[model samples]
Target: MWQQKKANRRMSGGAMNSGKWKEDELIQQMLRIAVPIALQFFMLACVSATDAVMLGFVDQTALSSVSLAGQIQFVLNLFVSGIAIGCGIMIAQYWGKNDPKSIEQLMPVALYANVLFGGVFTLLALLLPEQLMRIFAKDAALISGGAAYLRAVALSYLFCGISQVYLTLLKNTERVLLSSKISSVAVVLNILLNAILIFGFLGFPAMGITGAAIATVFARAVELIWAYLAVKQERTGI
Candidate 1:
């Protein structure tokens, strides 16, 4: 009976060690995925912060207008996020099954849906920016400022819609680091351009709120370009 107890103790100790090692391994894996995702979200948040800070320095109207104008974007993102999440689910499943072809099939469908949604918003912003702004604010000055911002930012919706699909696919395909890098670069560039264009630094004209919109569009374009190149290089059919 004593020998049996000693043997059982040894077995329990070994099992405990194995469980501990697995727990540590799982934590490390979680960090690897979580850190890059966290950083990406942080950088995206900074884009809005940059816009608010630079525009606030210009005037309260500009700041308020952009903030209200951003409501449309916030709504648009909700739809885009839904599409991305759906694509991610399929991609994750296919990836686990090692079925690249299935992922390719789903990619185009997601891209088309996202682009269509983005196009609708772009048209609304371009054609009836003032009306759209009026939906959010009754003040004429606020509506006028928001109209300018919306018109300037309209094209960015198309770019963001396309690029974000690619980013989502890349993340699910185990290219999280690459996607994070691309987003980080775009955010940094947007902030720098916001400073330059909004205040007319480096001999550029001070465009104020319009400049903020231009900066956002340009940064989104950069993201799209980078995503395109990465896709082509990888031949991932994205």
Candidate 2:
């Protein structure tokens, strides 16, 4: 009650903000958006954890190497996520301005930013995987394994560069659940692929850490395609 009264007092002067707190409605709406996103994130963490478990079965060096190489993805997320979220915030501004047409135009800018930053990181991972590995590791075996993993995973960066924009836009467009579903599916696929490829299941050749990276690339590609196909009809440019 106190929080509701405080909200009313703060919102009293602004016509757009003035309202009784529809507590049940507010909670439902928040959960509808938040829960899916949280689940998607948990699924993402599962991808890495699954990789570690599977790779540990193959060799300890591989497990450590992949764990190290995965830091590059963390960095990649930092840059690409910033651009994607910025695009979402800008799109929200368009809603506030009542300028829906301009919302379409923001995509190109976000795409360009994603590609620019993502490309740079991808190139580093692809071209200097060994050198990058040396930064976090000192063991020769670890360096070699991590480098291989980085090169294999570099391609995923390209896929994510484009997919992130689509996913972010989906959330901004009130399709948060859809976006999260796509991501969750991708993560699940990544884990399944990690199993089949890492240990060479179902007649597949064992690829070890390289297979894990390849699985990530394939999962990201699927995510990119799924997101694009889901939203393509609504978008005209890029």
With a 3 Å backbone cut-off (N, CA, C), the pairs that clash in candidate 2 are none
Clashing pairs in 1: none
- Model 1, span 1-238: residue lDDT tens: 9999999999999999999999999999888878999999999898888788889899999999999999999999998999988998899899889999999999999999999999999999999999999999999999999999999999999888888889888888888899899999999999999999999999999999999999999999999999878877887755
Residue-level lDDT tens digits of model 2 in 22-116: 66678888999899999998999898789888999998999999998888888889999889888889877876687767877888889988988
TM-score of 2: 0.88
Model 2 CA deviation exceeding 4 Å by range: 1-21, 96-98, 236-238
Which number leads on lDDT?
1
* Off by more than 4 A, model 1: 1-8
Q: What global local distance difference test value does model 2 have? A: 0.88
The best candidate in terms of TM-score: 1
